[model samples]
Target: MTTPQKIALVTGSHKGLGYAIARKLAQQAGIQVIVTSRKEQDGFTAQQRLATEGIQVDFHPLDVTNDSSVQQVTAWAQKTYGKVDILINNAGVNPTMQAEEASLLTMQLETMLSTLATNVAAVARITQAVLPLMQAQNYGRIVNVSTEMASLATIGSDYYPLAPSYRLSKIGLNGLTVLLAKELQGTNILVNAYSPGWMKTDMGGSDAPFTADEGAETAVYLATLPEHGAQGKFFAEMRKFGGPIALTW
Candidate 1:
């Protein structure tokens, strides 16, 4: 029997902004949203939580840093849903504190490496694994959840503060988004990097101005972009913020 709905794969969606994104997609887009997290319990809880809201959501265990885990999830997605029409690479990490304080000698190389593995490498790997299914249908939307802290323009202007490793990884992700978009420029796949404004999530901290719901708005918007919508652009919430900063290459 043909599935009754489209499928959206959202990573790190067990709670916070990821959960909000998945919930919105399921409720607004009428699609089967796959909620993924590293822990089974977390995923299950999120699945149950969304179900109570009268939304359709499924739990999947995915550790983006683990290739085997990524492969397993990709295989499951193909078998269960046939294809994933939308992918939100929302899984990321920011282990380091202030960028100024970080140094090659003082910084934890392991942590920095792990951060890049999740924030950048996994995104490319997962996208590659899922691209074929999307290609077959010639229709797809890929939204890479990036940060404004990754903006090179802002970093160079001295207006933006640095996060060193975290900023580097996000900038790399943005570059990947651009390259992927260019490669699939003529295809139905529209790839873009979305900077969900600073929100009060575990990563964004309680001092952030936006809530998870508010922060997820941009990602949800990009996930459902129309065929003619903008692609390969860096999008932030349409609100006033600090000036531009340059990213370290």
Candidate 2:
């Protein structure tokens, strides 16, 4: 029998790291890549871009913050692919204003709340919808795109001191990653937070070192991890960055 195709739903795949991850997965022989964005037009454009390179792809509009929109995408994945084998919770937002200082007091409540809603809450929402499907299959991989600044391991370091909203939200995201992995223990599904480092993107700015493709490498690797691969860790450059892979919250 032929190998089964793994169905993957990559959020915010219209551009940036998400786009690169989706493209890389689609290029693999037995992976059916589903690209999603908050905008339908952006989804189509991304789909067309991949198609021009001769990769077959599908698009679904997703607004991870909205329950209805999140459910809509999950329902489509269930209907179209039978099950979602991989989930990359990648769509995120940062403070729109330039960081004048690194202090939490300097950051506005609105900005932190906005960042938390998208960065932490939405990833949990989408994962909640997709987890059951993976549990039923007894196999899945969840790659939560996170940042190194979220590492409480280096909380006091001066150079990595700022972006309160983004950093704190990722800290919450990392917490979610740990909890989810614990809850899914003994199963094949592996949930982990991955830091792609700074890259050339809207949020990363042009001065960032890594290209979008280079940043997407680890997330793609985690998404395709084997049953025996590590789980429940903060990873960068394909290795565990801090502490143990599995631990309590």
Give each model's whole-structure lDDT: 0.82, 0.85
Write down the worst ten-residue block by lDDT for model 2.
240-249
Candidate 1 global CA lDDT score: 0.82
Displacement of the residue 201 alpha carbon in candidate 2, Å: 0.8
Using Cα atoms with residue i matched to residue i, what is each candidate's TM-score against the true structure?
0.90, 0.92
Candidate 1 displacement at residue 196 in angstroms: 0.9
Per-residue lDDT tens digits for candidate 2, residues 1-249, read 212789999999999999999999988778999999988999999999889999889999999999999999988788877899999999999773457335777788888888899999999999999999898889999999988778787766737658888888989999999999899888999998888877899888999777889888888888888887877887865434432233222
Work out how many backbone clashes candidate 1 has: 10
Q: Which runs in model 1 stand beyond 4 Å of their true positions?
A: 1-4, 98-105, 158-160, 238-249
| Alpha carbon deviation, residue 103, candidate 1 (Å) | 5.4
Candidate 1, residue 186: lDDT: 86
